[model samples]
Target: MADHLRDRFTAFFQKNVANPVMRRNPLQTLLETTGRKSGQPRRTPLGGSRVGNEFWFVSEFGDQSQYVKNIQANPRVRVRLRGRWHSGVAHLVPDDDPRRRLQSLPSFNSFGVRTFGTNLLTIRVDLDN
Candidate 1:
């Protein structure tokens, strides 16, 4: 019941406010995953770290996130970093400790994830050359 309400609230907030703001922010990172139902490209703003060829991020809603579900349907994804897009393959790392992973990411994003994230899920995206 509580989870349901949280989901509803989050959906409303993201759709009505957060997403629009993030989309316009030059510094914000965006994740592109195929839509599960529509099979169309879906872009979602996010925050994470890039190490070597891998991009890592922790989803606040975990599998409950629409993008995460899209990843489940198709692992292929794209990430926009520093104003450019990179193709990648997303890997869900349930065994990886999300709280620990957050420490290695950007501090501002990490703070929000730590504070608001409910079902944290670690995702690693292996970028293409």
Candidate 2:
């Protein structure tokens, strides 16, 4: 019951508050996914690190996340890193340990993910050269 309520509350806060503010920030990393139903572009602020040609992040809500669902429909995506957009293919890495993975990411963001996240899942985006 608490988890359900927390999910609902966090989803509302993220969609209504945090995301809007973060999206407007030039420095915030963002993931762009094609909407499956609307056939439109959707951008979500994310916390991740770029390693070589791959960008790594974890979805706090895992498969229940709308962005993850969009990725399921289309793996092709874009990521804004350091104010530049990069085209990439998003991959869900269920085999990766999300908790462990978070330890290697940005501390502040990782802490939020650990606190508010109900279902942790790792996502990897391999950028095109």
Candidate 3:
């Protein structure tokens, strides 16, 4: 029941997150990770896309979100996108190129700064090849 409630809560927030994109498309990715300190699973929902070999997650808001730090400490991430789940590791771009390019893409926007304030990371999700 708890997980069900959490899912509903997440869905509710995703609808009310003041996003013009979600207003049209309600489906997005929920990136789950392990908290470095708590050692518990933490989930962050965002509007993102998949690149060649990795998944790109961006959030212009929620600058102080702990999930970002968790990913920094442990890049391994599990993502649920459009009902399909994928597991991989993410590496922060720590530069402007990836973020700038993501912003230019039609799927994502300028929300990459929340992770590093313009230092957008090209989170390289390591997949099982």
Candidate 4:
């Protein structure tokens, strides 16, 4: 089916291409959450914005995403923005309207989310100074 192909393609591209490129890009924003099982730090490239002391981003796979599951088990996290890392506590806002939130984010990123994202979930991270 279409979904199956999309899933396979997404997995391949993310592992072989997107992740590697994002890891090296200084401008790319990243989210770091603790691994739920391994208790190791896990980082993933993301597109988001910081408002005051909070950082916001939408997950394409919602609760099904590994990072979201990690956030659920441990709210503590860190975010790298503009090459500076900041510690934060993540909060999953299931009640927030992700589509509406996307409209307020950067255009290029938002377009990708709106186009490719299937199960959108909004997350807000409260930074610790």
Candidate 5:
């Protein structure tokens, strides 16, 4: 499939199917980024792991992801991990190897990301203590 077509299809499935289900699960990890245009909090269910005071994840669509665009607009964000919310600053690490980073994250999500992601990008969130 062409990248644009795949992206569109995947985004549709995620928005209409996957995300709604995931968001309802209290155990699901979530990233809340301010809407770049609307200025409202937008919660996106994600798969990642917390290490020390930082949380790391790979964006399946790189800068093309809506949350990533929001991060570019406003780096300050909130993350919900294991049912607790933490405030943080989000950063896009273009230099990081997303494929290698995915190896360190949850296998299930990494699998989906690797399968559907066309342009993987690494994201790091420095959590507030």
Candidate 6:
């Protein structure tokens, strides 16, 4: 990653996404999903939190995220929450749910607003390991 882009994204994760309190705690979880076409695993680091017993994550890039689509068409996933990777599955928010309210919130980057892309895929996570 280029220095400038890396610095900017780091700022977003630190300031806007990752909680200040959780920074010191090993509470983060990363989801690594495979490309539906290639079958090879692609790891995309994300800031995750729990909603009840289920895990949740907001995509920084919305639906245009290849990994998001991949996981949508294929629910199985792999995760690395605390320096370890574990295989799991991911699912999208059903259109019928009231949780769809999240779509209205203004998206954010560390510096400013984030324009949503086509996929608009906001989904909950299910872990097997």
* Among all candidates shown, the one with the greatest TM-score: 2
Question: How much lDDT does each candidate structure score?
Answer: 0.92, 0.97, 0.59, 0.89, 0.97, 0.56
lDDT tens digits, residues 1-129, model 6? Answer: 464465466556645666454444554455667788998876665555545445565564555466777887788887666666666668776462322434343233211223322223456777665
Clashes of each: 0, 0, 3, 0, 0, 2
lDDT of 5 by residue, 52-96 (tens): 999999999999999999999999999999899999999999999
Worst 10 residues of 5 by lDDT: 1-10
* TM-score to native of every candidate shown: 0.92, 0.99, 0.60, 0.93, 0.97, 0.55
Candidate 2: misplaced stretches above 4 Å? none
Number of the top candidate by lDDT?
2
Indicate the worst ten consecutive residues by lDDT in candidate 2.
Answer: 120-129
Question: Can you list the residue pairs that collide in candidate 1?
Answer: none
lDDT of 2 by residue, 1-129 (tens): 999999999999999999999999998999999999999999999999999999999999999999999999999999999999999999999999999999999999999899999999999999995
Worst 10 residues of 3 by lDDT: 111-120
The alpha-carbon lDDT assigned to residue 122 of candidate 2 equals 100
lDDT of 1 by residue, 1-129 (tens): 887787678778987899988999876799999999999999898899999999999999899899999999999999999988999999999999999999999999899778767899999999994
Q: Which stretches of candidate 6 lie over 4 Å from their true place?
A: 1-28, 51-53, 94-120
| Residue lDDT tens for model 4, 1-129 | 786677667767876899788979887899989999999998898898899999999997789788999999999999999999999999999999999999889888888778777789999999996
By the lDDT metric, which is better: model 1 or model 4? 1
Candidate that beats the other on TM-score, 1 or 6, i.e. the better one = 1
